[model samples]
Target: MSQPEPGAVVDLLGVLAYAELTAFDRLAEDARLAPTLTGRAALARMAAAEIAHHVRLTDRLVELGADPAAAMAPFTSALDTFHESTRPSTWLEGLVKAYVGDGLAADFYREIAAFLPEPDRLLVLEVLDDTGHADFAVREVRAAIVADRRLAGRLALWGRRLVGEAISRSQAVIAEHDGLADLIITGTGDLAGVGRLIERITSAHTERMTTLGLNP
Candidate 1:
């Protein structure tokens, strides 16, 4: 693969740093909706992990000579809009968002990282690692569905909505950030490659939904 464009790397890191920071914030807020102390604490740990990931991304941005705040600034509005639009009203919804919604974003980033130079690619992969939320979410959500089969229908719809919002916001982020767009296009080799990337992410999302006992 060709060397990743330095500007694109910075843009990718900047957006990822901002995304992690917001993930921490969203998770912490969602913790309040948890039905039990155990669930709340689990979410709190996940929030801490997100902040830690944010720090790593920011540190890498600084190493690349970009101000962390400046790099993250451009993404704040878009990311915030997404969270605000999709804010969960129930603990179960929060869990699904953490699992399915955030998982979708992670899958997209991981796909693009394949096009990056080794160092940045590895950093991206590392920061995107699950913070134990996947199993936690799947366990909790599946149990909830068992207790109230009706919930399966509701959450399935929620998952679908999250996918649409996520894909839309993702496209917006890429379009707004040319460096990020270039990285994905360059890495994928063409627009069709980008389509295949989306297909993979969507397929993964369906698998995650099924894992949660929800209809894809």
Candidate 2:
């Protein structure tokens, strides 16, 4: 478990900043594999959105008197390992990974944001906004499934595996960061609150899968 000490807002911002930067790189790379001009453009735009977020988070970290690189450094391994292990084998896998992974991450952050105070809370909410990518993923994945019914089973399994890996990696992250782990441990205050948080995340994930026409 991470050192159980009190943490600053920079800790959270740093984590988010690094995650955004990494997502930008990955999305940009995936853009090259797009099957059509529309997809390439969409992915490029997505990557750019991530760059905007990374910049915001990095600037905020500087304002908070935290070294952006230092703040983000500790998280590289956890995130990198997860990405490497779950690297998609197909374009649809990439989309599914982005959709399912981002949804769960946003849900988790939103829950954690409830425990933050003032401007940071509002900032987190605003930065983590969906930007309609999930909807695009749902439409694309659904259309593909319609074209090949066999894809439904494989994609459903992929969705499940992605979420499961996410859960595992998230727990590892929480365990390694006192700021995050302590927040979840103390802010939730009781097992019941923790349970509720998990339930909310799970329910939201179910809805997202259903929207993608996949079984949860």
Best by TM-score: 1
Model 1 per-residue lDDT tens digits across residues 65-152: 8999999999999999999999999999999999999899999889988888878889999999999999999999989888989999
Which candidate number would show the highest lDDT if scored against the true structure? 1
RMSD after CA superposition, every candidate: 0.9, 2.8
Deviation in angstroms for 27 in model 1?
0.6
Model 1 spans > 4 angstroms off: none
For candidate 2, give the lDDT of residue 54. 86
Q: Write the per-residue lDDT of candidate 2 for residues 52-155, one digit (tens) a residue.
A: 88888888778777889999998899889888888888888888888988889889888887777767778888889876678778889999999999998999
- The residue ranges of model 2 lying beyond 4 angstroms of the native Cα positions read 1-6
* The 10-residue segment with the lowest total lDDT in model 2: 1-10
Q: Estimate TM-scores for all models.
A: 0.98, 0.94
Per-residue lDDT, model 2, residue 152, is 88
